[model samples]
Target: MIQTDGAFGRPTRHAPPLLNARHAEDYWQQATRCIDLVRRKMASVDRPFTGAHPEELKRLFEGIDLDAPLGELRPALEELERVYLDDAVYFHHPRYVAHLNCPIVLPGILAEAILAPINSSLDTFDQSAGGTFIEQSLIDWTANRIGLGQDADGVFTSGGTQSNLMALMIARDHYGAALADHGDNKHEGLPADYRRLRILGSEVSHFSLQKSAAILGLGYQAVMPVACDDHFRMDPAALKARLEECLAMSLIPIAVVATAGTTDFGSIDPLEEIAALCRAHGIWLHVDAAYGGGLLCSRRYRHRLAGIEHADSVTVDYHKTFFQPVSCSAFLVRRRSDLRHVTHHADYLNPLCQAEAGTPDQVNKSLQTTKRFDALKLWLTLRIMGADALGEMFERVIDLAGEAHDELARHPAFEVLLDPPMSTLVFRYRPADLCETELDELNAYVRAALSRNGEAVIAATRVDDKRYLKFTLLNPDTRLEDLTAIVERIVHHGRAWCEAQAPTRAAAS
Candidate 1:
């Protein structure tokens, strides 16, 4: 009832052939065509987004038939280019100050090209070979940069979210192991008093910590939020007070998740102070440096993360700050043996005997088994552009942020948040004629309108229940003038929307 293609179209006993050398030429041609289109799009100084509305996209996608392949490479590529590539948001554009996305370096792109064809699964030495070593080397390099001792070790993860999850998992297991007669939480679920186990994090910390607690059976209530200071950094005094309160209530504080770079405010918590507090309380310190990790190589800004070295574990997202592609992040621990908390031996994948016999398997440490070789992207980036070059780029963005902050502060139409600790600037357009409620609505409307028009892509967030726009300046080449234009456009839209609402508000009043 089935048919298999044979050589010269003759029937044969063999099954359908897998893609190998026989398809290499065709594959190369198709891949290069896609790459060429991407290169052109990246180079173009056009709108950051296509501003395609949801209804329009729904209508467009309805025409696509998924049951049958296009068969011809050229037609498929043309269709993709028309439907997707044309509407794709271009982070490399100078006006795109939207999120944590970065303009990837050339070496990272080239590394992707190489890795796609090889398709190496970086779980075991037998499968990855040199890939295992490369990933290990990167981990070692990152740990050393953090001043994590020689016993330090880590594994590449999907991104910051997964890295944070893995860090909390390790902390939970380590804490559980210390409890009376509770060996491993992985083998045995949390003890009967799991409700008392809690994770302490700043109010501004990423939401992943709470998610991790929920996933680890600790419940979202297990995460206690510590207050932050005037500058949005976690207040060490508040953290100490919370820890004492937890102790007084007979609650077990398993870990202190200090944020090196928070998402909205770009606030770097007082790492040195937090590290000392965690040390005194004997709490595991996991620093989520997903955004600020680039400061590791930044000669000028590296001091901002001075006490990161004291962390028990650190989450670094190279994709966010190192100009690498997505999914290039690692969760590092101070002691190599601590990673054993996540290890499991499988006869088919990694056997205990093979590990004992000196075989290096990355899966032993990672939450993921068949992981992508994302380390190669950062490796190639560092090799092609020296660490200092990357650092310089980071410095440029930080400097740009400072300039933009001053410019926004001077503008009467905008109310800038605390001076940026990193490259993100959070501000809201406050028109003189509008009240607090009206200003919030106006700012929110401005963000949506700009996105719908696709003139300049920016980010928006709420601070203290009031809407504020955020400019995440990750592009080193993004200048003050570009940001000024974006701000002007935001103001323009805010004013227009407010004026339009005036008649309706008067009628309602």
Candidate 2:
């Protein structure tokens, strides 16, 4: 059924779709109104954002009474449109190349419609039933895609942050178990020399690893930063040196976290070499493939994650690259037994008796007790649109990044970073006359000016304490011309800012 509210707000049904059959029609009618609100909003959206400031939106909500209800769905939606939807950032727009967020597929949205109404919680078999199996099936499929062997197992997670945290927790427990002085930190508490435990990651790796270190009771100090190469990949030589240094200092190197894709540069670590280093030291290997994990869907780019199969644990965020909605991600492990670290037998929930009966209790190996059936979105998406089709789409974005990087390098006024291993480009405007300090200010001003005018949305980051702009090209619909137009706007704003500062420069001279 095509969902539409069109130019009219008339009810399309007379009943609700859940619980009572009597109100089924009403539910579809109300659902259509909400769907059409989004449909109209996206269809009409010409810019990535509305340039609405915080104070402007705050004024819109200040006069509203939260206690009072509109008593009708239409009015409530109308109020939402005015306060939220109107000013909300449209990630689906082609110019929205700021973050890793992707334009979701229709199949995933349809899955959301079915899953939301039923609201199946995947904590236990009784609650989720078929949902548990569907999630497990997808986990198996993802494991196979990663070339993880038969013993591989995993559970769905909220996103990459939680997944990375889970990986580190398992690493901590697994490593702690082998130590003579440290034993079972999960239940027995941290060992006396827990301060000696260390986790190594690239300098360019996700911040989640440090956050995970803090959460694991190892303190942020436990994280050792390994240096990266010029292109921003974890240098294997640097990692080997760090490992030897840790051993020389009598510190316990618990794990090596290799980033498959660095956040800013889209650089993949030399995973094959890194895996070899982890194997040599018998250290737990955890690959944070959150951004590049989508390559698993691409037949052409699958080899980019060559050594991911060697990881003890891996974090993949479907929301980032798989084109799934938020809260859809998974944490995979090479050995099913490694999950014993995260397992807990709650008598009221997933009891030991259930395990004895050979029941699949997902909560036994999950960080979350109450979890949504997010796997359904992936399952339905794969079923309707084959993995090959999705892989082709991912390939397009990867190809687009290479083209943009080369084109950007030819631009005299801008400094484009190295070609991305995936679909991201880091560049900055550098006018000939400005000093290094002034270049930073000019690029930052351009980013803000574009957003201020609602012309285009671009992201900014700092490389070596110098400001730079970045393009995260996740949307396949975003073409070269669209990016070229954004570049024109950037140059426009940069020149304008320079001209406005001419008076100040003259006064300083």
Candidate 3:
């Protein structure tokens, strides 16, 4: 409780002053202790989750005074532990192969330690002097990696979703500009037939494309999903057909969105062939490489994303593949001039004269203002550990996926899907005695049981209305032995469920 200096017992809302030169020692002591608390918790953690039920946890936070302070950092942090840290999901655990979350590298953490205290905002040159230039350098380097050529330029975004949205937004305005004679399409708003403008994406592409279309005044239906081949990759022939159909129906194809790495299947579309189709149709080609962009660092697997250089725009999530922390992603364009669509000038912020005077205000490059110094994390990651080291870590996981796939296919009780083009594996448990109907329930039970026990955690998804399990292998430290143990636990729980149901079935029969 805060010390009450008032004459009465009434509580005061204020506790402490803000950090400044006088508070340097206080900040140092508090920050160190807080970081140590997390370090100890993380190091001592055994499982990915604590299996804490939602309702049970919600009760802990049921009633708290809105205006109250513990008056000390230690007490507040201790309270936070009870509600959050104690039961928080630790993605660093090798058994937590449920989603795209990756364990961060040490250099990224070190960079965060520095950036948090400085609190630099990257919106303008005056705000973040060296920060703006640092970000520009990283963007240029990433564009070079993607082979986007000399005219390439981009800006850091929150994540894949924001990056994809910006890419689609640019595609929309760029097409609208060409359609008109002489005017800024963005200022005049979407074209007269904006409803008819469609974006073609692979059937297995990220759902963010549809969300982006909806946000850009086009309905969700504006995103037309083309067919995929048996390998779960976008069929180039199918894409060609869709493009021709768009012309026949008098529907303008604003962009052809090809996925370099799909979410569930990890299958890469035929980028070169799709680029050809986009070129012939005079459509903007945007590649959503959020999952597979790490391939740029690998000389071995870089060929997989060969034709990405031809893309008019691309999205890459460094947090996902490069082992950086969350909210580190970039949206790159082939031509630097294309970024003018999202550029907005304000006298108080980035005025037109600032750009003319060659002052680098990142607000002109991004749709967002007051963005974080997320680029610093990536910058430090590359500086401390070279790109090759990150690539090797990524390569290890991809190799493990191939080995895991082969083992799952050979195993009698599991049904493995296509071989991953990157590092995610989609599969489900299937006993020979069970049919599809029983298998769905069993797989769902297995996933839930593992999660409830707090031993291992995995993912579940639906494939064409058919429920299946998934293993998104992003941890380099996750050995086959660990996967074997997870598989065994899944089998044990599934068999238990089946045995319990057997008595009911026999009695009914």
TM-score, predicted candidate 2 vs. hidden true structure: 0.96
Model 1 residue 231 distance off true place after TM-score fit, in angstroms: 0.8
The clash count for each model shown is: 0, 9, 0
Tens digit per residue, CA lDDT, model 3, 1-509:
56543212233565334566745666677778889999999999999998888997898787756478565666678889998999998889999998899999999988898888899999998989999988999999999999999999999999989999999899888888786464657668777888889999988889898899988889898999999999888898998899889889989889989998888988899999999888988899999999999998987899999899999999999999899998899999999999999998999999999899999999998989998999999999898899999999999999999998998899898888788788999999988777678788889999999988998889989998878888888899899988989999988998899998898768966
- TM-score per prediction, in order, is 0.96, 0.96, 0.96
Clashing pairs in model 2, backbone N/Cα/C closer than 3 A: 14-26, 15-23, 15-24, 15-25, 15-26, 15-27, 16-23, 16-24, 16-27
Comparing 1 with 2 on lDDT, the higher-scoring candidate is: 2
The models' CA-based lDDT, in order, is 0.88, 0.90, 0.88
Candidate 1: tens digits of C-alpha lDDT, residues 1-509: 34433222223355233447754655666567778877787677488887888787777677688976665556777788778888888898888898999998889989998887799999999888999999999999999888999999999999999999998999988988888888778888887788899899999899998789898888899999999998899999999999999989999999999998999989999999999999998999999999999999999989999899999999999998899988799999999999999999999999999999989999999999999999999998888898898889999999999999999999988899889989999999987877888888888888888888887888989989988999999998799999988888887898789779989989988
Q: Which runs of model 1 end up more than 4 angstroms from their true locations? A: 1-18, 507-509
